[model samples]
Target: MEEQSVVLVVDDVKTNVLIMRQCLKEMFQVWTADSGEECLRVAKQKPDIILLDVLMPGMDGYQVCRQLKADPETAEIPIIFVTAKDSDDDEQKGLEIGAVDYITKPIRPAIVRARVSTHIQLKQHSDKLKFMALHDQLTGLYNRHFLAERAAQSLSAMVRHQQELSIVMLDLDHFKKINDFNGHHIGDLVLQAVAKLLQDCFRKEDVVARMGGEEFVILMECGLDIAREKTEDVRQQLARLNPMGLEVTGSFGVVTANPQNAELSHLLVLADEAVYKAKADGRNCVVCYQDGAYLTVEHD
Candidate 1:
């Protein structure tokens, strides 16, 4: 099924909102905000496109556009100013504040629809390109480059708030045997399946990434106890995945993020150590880093 793109229409006038809704409803899911404050709040829903009206009471469209552009979360959402001011100067100001296009008042349905459709298509293309750059093509998991960036940002916030953070480094045990006995095509399918299951095992806030061949990592917001339990859960799930009668199991190494030593590289090193320990203890197990030691956790 094709995903429905959302269009946020912000106007003080109810008639304007109704008109735009009527014009665009066939092509997009329409949402409305009658004032600037409501527009800012609704924008957090991450609409695919926004049709904003200038001259709203207190906060104008230009001001609202500036705020949206300033926020990293909402900065990329396409905005178009639809207002009564037709002067070139007014249009220039709208574009200057990050409005993608400007449409004067006395709305023409065809023109509004055409402009909105063009901008929405452009935004969709931009998002697809960004996803290709940040994600792994084979497994649809995040690539290592994006992983480092996200890990750094997440760690910074965790440290500032003194919240617990954990990293789980996982490797498919005896994965080479499967690739050698079967073929790369079968191996690829196994990797994809593992990636999907790992993603399902964690919360949305957690970061799951394909580090490289047969390796994955999860950055989650929890301490040792919860991390260990989750790691074991993943291990048991992988063991149950017998693709083509081939036994599948993964070794996991987990480490909590220490605020004083919270660098991504440092965390990876600790997690790696724990994973190696799991391997030494005869694969298909979980090891956790605690109090400067990597200790194997007995399965629950």
Candidate 2:
């Protein structure tokens, strides 16, 4: 099951904390702090949202907010200032200090609930939009732009860690033919189905993307043997999906990153060539780029 959203309620007054907790307990996992110092300590646990009271005895909400914003770990968490100071200056200060919203006290329970719910929903929606922007809409996999960006970053990490990195480019076999016969809608369904299969086969950390049309790419921080195994797994999965009537299969090409091949574009080209070889040898197979060449996997 998914984890419940967590909220941190910070107020010097016990009564105010209790009231806020009562209002939020139904929808969220709640934590409270009686002082700004304690609020900082509790924030280390990383609550999804924070309800902060501005009129605390020591280290008020503004100071607490500034401290939270200063810390890289807690910087992204949304903060809402709940205070009796409802003046224009108070609101301006709260906004300027990076608080997302402000609610004046003697808080209305209904308003509190509504505002919290709205912000949480907006956060969730914003996350979805970010995912969509970086991923293919039809396949629900990373798109070309995301793939390139991720590949470059992965390459940089590989260099820093002195680790091996491999890129596998997979192109669906005769994908345009499927669209020609089955209509574009069925083609889209087939792409989504294939994407789900890929996600299941690869680790969550591995970068997987649909690089336009019937092509997809996988970037892995693994040796050649493991890359081969993973490539075969994806190929077999696609082949198994042929019974779905779209007749889907994939040809894969792999290229490992080396000192001689530092350029991402160069590795992609090598992988593309290997993919071409897989098609030449007979589609629906995997090929590895080795010593600036591609070798096909021959089966008995």
Candidate 3:
């Protein structure tokens, strides 16, 4: 079952807060705040929509909306001004300052419910579209564009923090033979299973992306020895996984470096070369590139 969307009702009056809560209780999980200060602080709860009262003391709804819109962390949340201020200029100001909508006071529960539902639906649709743009359609992993963007951020971490980053390039050995024997449908299923394995093997903070086809890249914040061990784990697990009742194995190329000295692209090229050596030495093995040489990481 889908969870209820969170709605925050911000009104200085207890009665107004209760009324708005009653209006949205059936459709959303409602949170209430009596002041703009409290609203800004409670916004850490990350509500999906905010229904704000404009005429309140100690920072009006317009001020809260401006702060929210100015901060990238909260800017995307939809805001609706529910206020007694019915002047044309007031409504204009609310809308211009980033409120998705403006609802005048003497609140109608029906109108509030209708508008909230509509805006929430719009937000959900937009979020889904954004997810599609960033993710691989086949494996649900981060796509190439998303990887490049995230890699830029990781590169900054390397330069600013003197962080060591490990890059692993993985390719399925004889993947074409698997497809030629079983057909592309089975090949797709194999790819999905491998994608899940990669996700399971790495931490959430790690950057795991499917570059294309049977090739995938993983970026980890660690040194050479740790990366080689992690890469060995992936190789051992993939060898054991008889996904779809067929044997599946992968060749891994591990490269660990302080990325201030090398870009992400250079690391990938080095890893790709290691993967090539792994394939030539016979598949289903982990190879590490270190000290200007490739060494096969032997695993039991």
TM-score versus the correct structure, for each prediction? 0.91, 0.83, 0.92
lDDT per residue for candidate 2 within 1-300, as digits (tens), equals 777888899998889989999998988899989999999999999888899999888798999999999999998788999999999999999999999899999989999988888887777788788888898888789998898888888888788887889998989999898889888888888888888888899999889899888888888888788898888877887787763565788899988898678678998889999999999989999999887567887643
Quick one: ranking by lDDT, best first? 1, 3, 2
Top-lDDT structure, candidate number: 1
Score candidate 2 by TM-score against the native: 0.83
Over 4 Å off, model 3: 70-72, 259-261
Candidate 1 residue-pair clash tally: 0
Compute the lDDT of residue 112 as modeled in candidate 2. 91
Evaluate model 3: give its lDDT. Answer: 0.91
> How many pairs of residues collide in each model?
0, 0, 0
Which one is best on TM-score? 3
Give the clashing pairs for model 2. none
True-structure lDDT of candidate 2: 0.88
Residue ranges of candidate 2 with Cα displaced over 4 Å:
1-7, 24-48, 54-74, 84-93
